[model samples]
Target chain A: EAGVAQSPRYKIIEKRQSVAFWCNPISGHATLYWYQQILGQGPKLLIQFQNNGVVDDSQLPKDRFSAERLKGVDSTLKIQPAKLEDSAVYLCASGAGAHQETQYFGPGTRLLVL
Target chain B: SQQGEEDPQALSIQEGENATMNCSYKTSINNLQWYRQNSGRGLVHLILIRSNEREKHSGRLRVTLDTSKKSSSLLITASRAADTASYFCATGARGAGNMLTFGGGTRLMVKP
Candidate 1:
């Protein structure tokens, strides 16, 4: 079976610019998530969605970062006015359910802010 | 903040040797999982041990959880060069749905 898919494996933008990443989860998966991984650090959860509805986004930087899973199959994460600190790999993962399930990850988008 | 923290930020070993990595978490968890990430790639789940389980083995990998100390360990026996990667331990905390909090990761290098 195909795994999660993401677009634009790499991206570069100037500070204050806007960048967007897209993710297509595994077929039939019901939960999707976005995570940010800085160099030399583990990925940190940014937002989570369960079939077009957000389950958790408490760690999301609502002031500049936003994500949406409109159809529950694909999702997008956007960062407006990006900062140099935002340079990191953004990963998208999907799971079959919202409990005790394994998460499948995409190749991830590596973003660089100049 | 991350709930799990891995020890020995980096390790180096020759092929056919054994490699061990440890993870400690701060809160109650429903399960702990280990993932491997090759440089510049996404993470791949290795193993998951539930709270009620004490040990699990998958091929060359063995995982042990000690809830009393809130720590878990991953042992990879007869390691190969292909096993060189960053290992991360993630905690699925109670009431957190399916979300996982990952640790800083342990970088393991196995020489062929």
Candidate 2:
């Protein structure tokens, strides 16, 4: 089966500019997630969606970041007025509904804000 | 605030040896998962152990959980140079949404 897919494997932007990342989850997956991974650090959950509905986004930066999964199959994450600190890799993952279901991840989009 | 924290930021060992990594969390969880990442690629799920379970094995990988202490450990036996990568532990808490909170991860390097 095909795994999660993401676009623009690498991105370069200037501070204060806006950038967007896209994700296409595995077929029949019910849950999708977006995470940020800074250099030398683990992924940090930015938001989660269960069938186009947000499940959790408490850690997301409301002032600058937003995400949406309109059809429950594909999702997009946007970072506006990007800051230097926003330089990191954004990863997307999908999983079935089971609580212990294993998640499949995409190659991720590496963003470098200058 | 990060829910999990991995010990030993980095580890280096020779091929054929065993490599172990530990993780600790602050909250109660229903299950814990381990994932591996090579270079800049996305994470690959390795294994998962429920709270009621103490140990699980998959091929050369072994995971042990201690709910009482809110900790888990991953052991990779007979490691190979190809096993060099970063390993992260994620926790799924009950009623805390299905999202997972990951730890800083442990970078393991197996030299031939």
Q: Which candidate wins on lDDT? A: 1
Off by over 4 Å in 2: none
Candidate 2 residue-wise lDDT, A1-114, digit = tens: 898999989999999999999999999888899999999998999998988899889899999999999988999999999999999999999986556257789999999999
lDDT of 2 by residue, B1-112 (tens): 6789998889999999999999999988888999999998999999989889999999999999998989999999999999999999999866634668899999999999
lDDT scores of the candidates, listed in order = 0.94, 0.92
Clashing pairs in 1: none
TM-score, B chain alone, candidates in order? 0.97, 0.96
Weakest 10 consecutive residues of candidate 1 chain B by summed lDDT: B91-100
Docking class of 2: medium
lDDT of 1 by residue, A8-106 (tens): 999999999999999999998888999999999999999989889999999999999999999889999999989999999999999865473688899
- Each prediction's TM-score against the native? 0.98, 0.97
Runs with alpha carbons beyond 4 Å of true place in candidate 1: A97-100
